[model samples]
Target: MKKIKITILFLALLQTFSAVAQSSKIKNLENQREQIKKEIIEINNLLSSNKKEKNLTFRDLEILAAKINIKERLIKINNDQINLLNADIKSNEIKSEELKLENENVRKDYASMIFNSYKSRLKESRIMFLLSSSTFLEAFKRSQYFSQFSDDRKKYSNKILKNLTSLDSINKILKDKIVNKEDLIKSNNAEKRDLSNERNNKNNALSSLKRKENAYKRQINQKQRQADLLDKEIDKLIKEAIRLSNENKKSSTFSLTPEAKALAESFTKNKGNLPWPVERGAIIQKFGLQPHPVVRTTKIKSNGIVIATTKDANVRSVFEGVVLSILKFKGSNLTVLIKHGNYISAYKNLSKVFVEKGDNIDALQIIGEAYTNINDNKTTLQFSIFNNTTPLDPYLWIAK
Candidate 1:
């Protein structure tokens, strides 16, 4: 019986630690869910702002798709939380039943102990037991037996109380977990309904876009031409900067000073942890060749990701660098190129420029405001990173 009690205690301790770990996991999931919820709200605001147009455009459809994606993620997190709660509830239920059975056995033992003590009292008192002893040795032994019997009665009483308290606590935890699970299930179901409606809206928009496929194709081609121009301009400027850095020698890269080299090393080491150019935004266009969101047949290649943000959101520098050049192109906003040794980060599509050429800039320093198109009511930041002249995906470098 003592071994059984010890085993139960060990199991209880293990369960306590396991509960703490499980609680941590649930907390992490809740944090992620909250962040995703905020993103959904941002996307909804973007959609609301674009509602000024009489009909939905490809941009509207893109925002809707993003919303649906985030909504699904939120629901998945909710399901995960619910699953954890279910496991906890099941474990608690098993423990409660075990406690109930143990308590029953203890109650039975206490009853038997009380009945035996009563019968002993009826036969002879403890004082009489000592007086009736035939010798001093026997009296001492009888006294010890009476003391042990009293201790045993107290131990049984305390055990019963402890078991009852533990059972009550477990029952309370089970009730709370069940209620939490039900709430999560209700939330998940509501999100699913919203997700279904968004999908329908996206499908309707896609159908409308298909009705004007040829026009969209032309627009895609025109956009590609503009991108090509921007790419060439960026490359030319980088080459020119390299030429100036290596004036006495012929090289295709910048001749880095010790300070510049250290900066570049730090920048390379901080990959995937770089800050965003815009404070609050979502990547609408990803890097590299992907089928156009609207016209799948028309492939669009991007050297960097395009972030859609609030109107006139300020664009910041991702790292410390010297502004290499301030450039502008026809039918496009201004571009600022900052050189971190041989690595170059470019922020384009600015309505207003803050820093000038040769100016030193720090990370998160505001450089310009993102241009907001009045026609579509969309504001986007075009961000790119390059190693010498080779284009690297901005999405890979920026924090998720």
Candidate 2:
């Protein structure tokens, strides 16, 4: 029965667009920041375990560099949250001011009506007003008028009360927003401190690494040859698989059954949404060419992403497909290839194989345990997905 609803309709309509959009954007950013923070913690723990090594290995530099990258991103996210909270605080302050003005106007009107009502009641008592009517019908109309007038006054009074309540609610919300913004500022400052510490550690690591230039170059060269060999072997095995698939058919690539074709379609549809090959690993090496994280002049290229994990971590299948072949490099163990119609996913550097070459595997199924190198005291998985013999960047298909 309060006209406050009508008065505030415009304000409500104006906020509709930003309400969900701003809240959800902030929530999404916060979630991402938390995930990256957890990853930094994991990487820190992993790197700390290797601190007792006689030398600061290139792998150590890589891990430290990765941590620095995440820390930088984390700081950026914190700043973004603070910016968002500031915008929200400003928006709420404006809305609160509007509500205050509206409340004031409503109170003025209610007070005027109350004053006028008292004057009328004093000038003409209800019984006197009713008896003053010339006829019975007129007296009955007069009584109805008085009743309606009382109801109108009560309704306006209620409106004023409702407006006051809304103003109070707005004030409360503004206070809460101010408090939240303060909390965010504190968090942002704390992250900035942590970032500073990481940067210092990075500088120390870089200085130590620069002292062993030749040793570092040798490590880089060795790793590059291994990667090149792995790539060659992967190409060879996948080409053979495609050849076998096309052996009986006129198709240049694999001739698929209807079900296999459908499965491939589904897998393609889930690009950027596919599960990661390993549950708990950070992508130590990314797809495509980039300057090495530690060695600025040196370039590193990867057809697929390399995920570093705990020793003997589970290497899971990204999609359901039949295993094609399990090949091995000289040092690294078996690498399993799975075929889903025209698409193939490769999981390399595996220590122990779980499924056979011809076994039917489901999505997220554990294909093998990643290799643990006693020399470096590390475990890593080189995961690649292919469309026939052509390599695809594994990062594109995997979930964030």
Instruction: Kindly report which residue pairs in candidate 2 clash with one another.
Output: none
Worst 10 residues of 2 by lDDT: 243-252
Candidates in order, TM-scores: namely 0.75, 0.83
Give one digit per residue, the lDDT tens place, for model 2 in 213-296. 778877777788888888898887777766666784544467778998999899899998889888887777778888888887
The candidate maximizing lDDT is 1
lDDT of each: 0.89, 0.83
Candidate 1: lDDT over CA atoms?
A: 0.89
- After superposing candidate 1 on the true structure, give the runs of residues whose Cα lies further than 4 Å from its correct spot: 1-14, 131-144, 214-276, 283-305, 318-348, 357-363, 383-400
Question: On a 0 to 100 scale, what is the lDDT of residue 128 in model 1?
Answer: 92
Which residue pairs in candidate 1 have backbone atoms (N, alpha carbon, C) closer than 3 angstroms, thus clashing?
none
Candidate 1 on 1-400: residue-level lDDT in tens?
9999999999989989998999999898988788788778778888887887797777787678778778888999999999999998998999999999999999999999999999999999889989999999999999999899899999999999999999999999899989989999999999999999998988888887787768878877997899889889889999988888888578888899999999999999989889989999877777999987656677999999888899989999999999999999876789999998889999989999999999999999999999987767788888999999999999789875
lDDT of 2: 0.83
